[model samples]
Target: MIRLEGITKSFAGKEGAVAALDGIDLTIARGEIFGIIGSSGAGKSTLVRLINLLERPDGGEVFVGGERVTDARGQRLRALRRSIGMVFQHFNLLSARTVAGNVAYPLELTGAYGRNEIAVRVAALLDRVGLSEHARKYPRQLSGGQKQRVGIARALACEPAVLLCDEATSALDPQTTGAVLDLLRQINRDLGVTVALITHEMDVIRRACDRVAVLDRGRVVEEGPVTRVFLHPRHAATLRLVREAEPDGGSLDAAAASDLGGRAVRLTFTGPAAHKPILGRIARENLVDYAILAGRVGHIRETPYAQFIVSLSGRDVAGAIAGLRASGVDVELQGVAPVPEIEERACHVV
Candidate 1:
């Protein structure tokens, strides 16, 4: 588990000191996949570094596994860092080392294991990451995904309790990205390792996170379960992210949907509701003619979900909206200005 309180970090800029993180408070529960999403300059990488004491905050406290590590020094700090593994956005592998050697490097650095022990550990890690066959391959000879697998194997060499994936899938193609994400999920489940994923891609969050925090301008604008945040994003930055991740091949933007005229509402269906005949049944029952502007049916980390924006005409439009809501569908009136609400996540849970 990780907890940060009033966390603030600033850096020297051309103009002056620039705040990279400001008054941030977050808690990541043990054994959960937590996500931090934002655009560039959201301080995502900087924040992750703070967890491992790679970047000390300008102010506030840093706690890892319930120990206050803000002021830890010498051996204490080194021990704490060893308990938290980190995966980089870029595959920061030693090109000079082969796959097995790369994984063995971290264990060798600890000076706690003998040569035989390190060799056994390295072999097990390579097998765990499905790279046993490529143990002798060099980084340059591997594909992007393979190289990342090597990085992951290296990170796991220490058997850290928490794995910090800072844009771990950002450099790969979509198909490769999905494979990496799936691998992370597998690691989380099989190893009981708490994963904190940092990325700009909403799809990554949707695919991998149990809960998420949306960052904008170095502050957390919203945080909650992925289902709630992805389905009914309450912040402008969060809304934009959901739109960008639309599986309907880019849903109509607010500006684009404005000219459609009829009363428009976005509907979100989840779980069994996603498979129900809610839309057609409600339309007929309420006698409302509907036009779907954009939508898609998909899964968010195995939870079936569907979302669509519909323009409603004919009578009883209100009745139709009510019907959809009564059927477990979340209906949001389109074009309505969003009220930014930061839902406090169960980050404090132990």
Candidate 2:
């Protein structure tokens, strides 16, 4: 329930004004977990802050639930902010305040609830985050995961409709990161809160977000459903991020060369058509040797897709490729590898 239209933010630099967000146009549907991903200096954090008016845009409009949020002053701004809760990577909790106290602080600021109501809300929120036992502990008394749970409880104290997470799990260990992500997913599902997370971790996006926008150098290079984007990333930056999570040596060109070696074709399969056992049937029917060089299995939108590199050795490599194409496989033959002669190593013919 948030939209940013042509939002641009620039700051004075030594040479000139440097744009942090360049004409960012994006929309977050109600009750959807949206992810914004980019490398360092890509303005991801800046863009998120603009959504809550923590950083005012230099140009364009910021709308929350279709209501304009820019240029708001005093009470208007404060009220708008209360509707949006933010969590950070650092787990910004006060060392002096106990977990319960920290959560109650936000409700106190709203000043619309009595002491008992605030106490009830705080206890419920703490229990929701699975930190009911740690209610009396200060920030220093808890672990990183516990501290983040406190931050999450504090964020939910106001019952915000939109939650902004800026690298929320970056500072935690992998196991704890997963735990936090699960909590976020539960928050979205149970509370129906619209979540917008800015993170560099694809695993986080894959596990949590329903849609994603890939930002590069203050501009969104790609945006779409999480599964679609993961399966067929159109941008180089997007591909880079995906590849980082599952590393494969060499570039795409190098991979093509090593796999094909000017011998066989490269095939691309997407959607439901990719699920067929094409390779198995081809190998079984053809009396030729097929050597698989490199391949990987990955999930996009929680669906399995495989990318493979293989070599075909026989007198009729072209025939095998043609047969595959005829069967509705996307095949591309690069060149040909020199046919190797089979020589008798020893006297097998006794």
Best by TM-score: 1
Clashes of 1: 0
Query: How many steric overlaps does candidate 2 have?
Result: 5
Each model's RMSD to truth, in Å? Answer: 6.1, 7.1
Which whole-number lDDT from 0 to 100 does residue 83 have in model 1?
A: 94
Deviation (Å) of 14 in candidate 1: 2.0
lDDT of 1 at 41: 95
Give the poorly placed runs of model 1, Cα more than 4 Å off.
246-261, 336-350
TM-score of each: 0.92, 0.84
The 10-residue segment with the lowest total lDDT in model 1: 341-350
Pairs that collide, model 1: none
Q: Which pairs clash in model 2?
A: 262-335, 262-336, 263-335, 265-332, 266-332
Task: Write down the lDDT that model 2 would get.
Answer: 0.79
Over 302-350, each residue of candidate 2 has an lDDT whose tens digit, in order, gives 4655555556766566777877778776665544432111111111110
Off by over 4 Å in 2: 247-278, 285-290, 298-301, 311-350
